[model samples]
Target: MSKIRVAVFGCGAIAQRRHIPEYASNPNVELVAFADPNKQRAEEVAAEYGGKAYENYEDILKNEKLDAVSVCTPNYLHAPMTIAAANAGLHVLVEKPMAVTAEEGEQMIEAAAKNNVYLMVGHNQRLMPPHVKAKEILESGRLGRVLTFRTSFGHPGPEGWSLDGRDSWFFRKDEALMGAMGDLGVHKSDFIRYLLNDEVVEVAGFIGTIHKEDTDVDDNATCIVRMKSGAIGTLMASWTHYKGGDNGTVLWCENGVVKIGTGQGDEVIVELTNGTVETYKVGAMATNEKQVPSGVIDDFVQSIITKTPPTISGEEGLRSLKVILGAFESQDTGSIVKL
Candidate 1:
């Protein structure tokens, strides 16, 4: 079988540092080309990976015999790029949060379905070993019924992480669509949904730009959710959690509770009503062991070969986006928004 040809549509830090290396080393994939609006950055990444560089992403879509493309562009570009790739008959692996809005995410899903191509979202947290174990544990029914939960993802604002520091789209409402909620809250929202196997039906939230200056979006946000299953949750997502403590998921259930974090390799720690604390560890993809990001990329490639839907499909991505948007709506109205 011919290795699946892959092209990355952004030479930003994420593409160059993670996606390119993962694709270049995957046995079943060939790193074929790259595209970026910035010519020099695109050329640099392309040269580093032994691939061709195109200033315009359309160039790669029009010419390469690519089986898939990783839409590694910024938050706003995610929808357009994924839709284009799908319409061109290429499987799309979009970076997290799906897109800025549920409507946009729906369009991406529609395009993929219309063209008969796969559309997967890169919610890499779902691919992490610890998170994997947590999901399995919850599914095993050992925790009984979940009553409430809390999850978070944060880092000192994306100053160094983004292409431009404070001036980046991350701080701009027009480009990012939402602040911390879209950036990190959605990951937790997805994790919670996956863990509980429920759709969030209502939300009450507080969204604000508490820390950053001259930013149009929130730097800090908090939300309380009511799931369809009647379980409730409190979530905090911010770019200001630079103090860094136990930053992961915690579920409170009728039987006991489950705590997930990086301290135990992101393992799931379960405490039962019987006063027993058990830990379960989820293993990583061997070739990319010790590296969590590769698991997502590897799965994306495997989905293309197996003609399977990725664990985080485009529809699932939209569900996650809906949660985030609900939080925003809740914030705007200062009332519980029902899904």
Candidate 2:
């Protein structure tokens, strides 16, 4: 089997920690190029990760002969870069917050389809072992129908994660777009949407910059959602968990409540209404301090090689982003926004 020629369009934290490393480790992938505005950083990664560095993504799309590319840039650049790569006939695996707007995401989807290339969003939560287990339990319907749920994804902010620290693009509104909502909440939106196999039909949310000092975007946010299955849920994202982080979900069903990422040492704990309890060891969520290799890059490469659609397709990203976009609208309008 021939290796898939691949390139990374950003050389930052996500690229370094997940995409580049994972791609390098994938036997089917031949890491060929790296692109970044900072030529030096790109060169540094290229030297270690086995790729030629280019300062501009356009250069890579225009010149390289590659089968796939990973768009790991800031939230704002996701759609444009992915569209360009697709138009150039390269498959894409882009990071979350697919685009600033669903319309932009649509353009990306259209480009990928028009060019007959695959577009996969990096909704890595779908690949989390605990989340996979949760999906299985929910599908069993052992707890009956899901009635309500609550999920949270937060950290100390991206400062520690980014190489630039406090000076990272995450603190800049124009670059990062929104804060915790985009950085963290979007992940919950994707995961929750997947777990329930339902779409959020309406959203009522509160977004704020209450905690972070001098930040133009919100550092904290919470949204109440009504899903198509008639399930009502609360989704929250924050950067102000000064004490620690709460990245987990709790589902309340007619027969029981299933908790994923809640208990210590037990990532998944399911409690039935009958008073029976169960604990699952599906592995822990990836943390900044102790990160795990994600399956995103490998899946993207395999989808291209197998001529199959990616699980987290461009459409999936657009659909999940709709809930987040609606939440922003609801926050601004002080009322519920229907999808």
User: Considering every candidate listed, which one attains the maximal TM-score?
Assistant: 2
Q: lDDT for every model?
A: 0.82, 0.90
Q: Which ten contiguous residues of candidate 1 have the minimum total lDDT? A: 284-293
- Residue 241 in candidate 1 has what lDDT? 68
Candidate with best lDDT: 2
lDDT (Cα) of model 2: 0.90
Error of 2 at 66 (Å): 0.7
Error of 1 at 169 (Å): 2.7
Clashing pairs in 2: none
Off by over 4 Å in 1: 262-265, 281-291
Q: Write the per-residue lDDT of candidate 1 for residues 26-84, one digit (tens) a residue.
A: 89998889998888988888777777989998889888898899988778999999988
lDDT tens digits by residue: candidate 2, 33-71: 999999999999988977799999999878888988999
